[model samples]
Target: MTDNKRFLLRRRPEGAPVETDFELVSDAIPAPPAGGFVLHNHFASLDPAQRGWMDDAPSYMPPIALDDPVRATTVGQVHASDHPDYAPGDWVMGLNAIEEYSVVVPDGFTAKVDVSAVDSPSRFLSAFGAVGLTAYFGLLEVAKPQPGETVLVSGAAGAVGSVVGQIAKIHGCRTVGIAGGPDKCARLVERYGYDAAVDYRGKSAEQLADAIREVTPDGANIVFENVGGTVFDAELMNLAKHARIVLCGLISEYNSETKHGARNLWQVLAQEATLHGYLISAYVDRFAEGGAQMAKWIASGEVVMDEDIQHGIDNAYPAFMRLFSGANTGKLILALD
Candidate 1:
């Protein structure tokens, strides 16, 4: 295809992102120059982190410039290459713009994929990609979950959270997941092996706290926090002494103008809890080790991978919105083919 279709950042969103926040533009695909390759993107990984990247604020990565194709991690086939390391028709993964085609340097985050190791190209963007890596390092390295500990995960049915709960279970921790609806909660218990599941939908703070207390009678020793709003507040109320709180992502406040400041932070002091906020990039050097171990668990049937994929790049906008609305059960991916 000579024409590349891409979604460009139109404006910074005030609250939840709307379609108007981005503009879909079609342009001619560019050829690779020397030491570069042309990628025909087949899958775009939609993440909550993308929302933060859209804003014109100081963050770990620079914000996407207005009218530029939005930044995303993509899995694609190398269409053409001037780089000796990559050849046409090779499947690769890397940081790329949200377009049908991207020009990439052989170095940096771009790497050839081992198709034999994964079920499909989309799987690389899911469990085997940043999602699983985030869960693995966050739980094992940061939380330091101990066997027989009570582990609670918020946003338990999401890409990262689902994996977090399962990894906690593998460590012999009693896992409790807090998801939005009853069905997702059921999936946490039935499919992901969480010992208990709490549905936070339509429930008051008191009710949510009661539900958490019921599952974690001795209090939570480790809390894998993904959604940071009332759900986090509820978890804070039930923290055990020296509780380890892995502050992964705050999806609840990503789009809002006013963030939900946790009123119960004092509990962290009283309970002698350790609250840690981390970026996945911090563990970059050890990603290979983490990915290898996750692959072993998946291969042995000890860990299950779940994905909610939306076909076509045309659906990328609405599909991305699903993450905030809790419409996706696991990893949310946009398949271009």
Candidate 2:
């Protein structure tokens, strides 16, 4: 019998995960039931949320238990099937573990997709999957950007940020993206259509806030927060009247030993800004609606997918580490085959 390699959570991570936090093991493929599908995995989605998933905390989803196969969002090709809805050779994306193969149930997961229509199959996990959905419902549904408003997006050159900035620009909002370096800042403006991009590498939180205020003189109308730490505190101090803050992620504090709390959250009341945090899975029923619109924009060249895929599944740990260090340019993902 052939063995499938999978990554499992050995113990709760102390801070940033090292190889010891996970254990790679080979397992035999189990027999499929009468109506299940067996898939040979290809790509796995590495997200900052996965860090929270490893911790035993009250979150949008349950945390992975010790000795459990590490939970993740992944895409793969069907190798065998018993369900009438699927067949061999069909490409699919869904919530699965980081493994070489998986037995997917028809319920509680997304069906197979046609990857040829988009830039890459990996985009299903990115611009068209969780990232796109996060950008869509968070920015459009939650923030409700109006024309001529100033929108500030943190982690603005990363996976969800790239999409959020583009969507804001599409709505005719003055978009400002905050990233780590100059190259990412440039790409945010030149490629993703942000009105301005700020590099936060050498600047202090206060200086970054000043730069944001400079780009948005009237104060930020919307703050799409992906990195929550001192940045969120600074952004809180610059909110316009009745502004909206959509809390998408907080990668900055993901691996922190001592969690940082928002000190300037009182500014929400002072600035008359509303802060809302949500998970994309909460809006799963409306995915088709958002996906179709995003697809149309992408097809019309209105939205672009800028994915940064690492070469192999073995690179999953390293690729995941990149998110913490701000090493990736766009959607950070792994390609196994």
Q: What is candidate 2's TM-score against the reference? A: 0.96
C-alpha lDDT (0 to 100) for residue 282 of candidate 1: 89
Give a tens-digit lDDT track for model 2, residues 153-210: 9999888899998999889999988888888889998999998988777777788778
Question: Which stretch of 10 consecutive residues in model 2 shows the poorest summed lDDT?
Answer: 103-112
Maximum-lDDT candidate: 1
lDDT of 1 by residue, 1-337 (tens): 6699998899988888889988888898888988899999999999999999988888899988888888999999999899888899999999998899998986567778888777888878887888999999999999998899999999998889889988988889999999988899889999999999999998877789998999888999999999988899999999999999999999999988988878689999999999998889888788789888988998998888898989877887998999988999888988886
Residue 51 shift from truth in candidate 2, angstroms: 0.6
RMSD list, candidates in order: 1.1, 1.4
- Cα deviation of 305 in candidate 1 (Å)? 1.2
Tell me the lDDT of candidate 1: 0.89
Could you estimate the TM-score for every candidate?
Answer: 0.98, 0.96
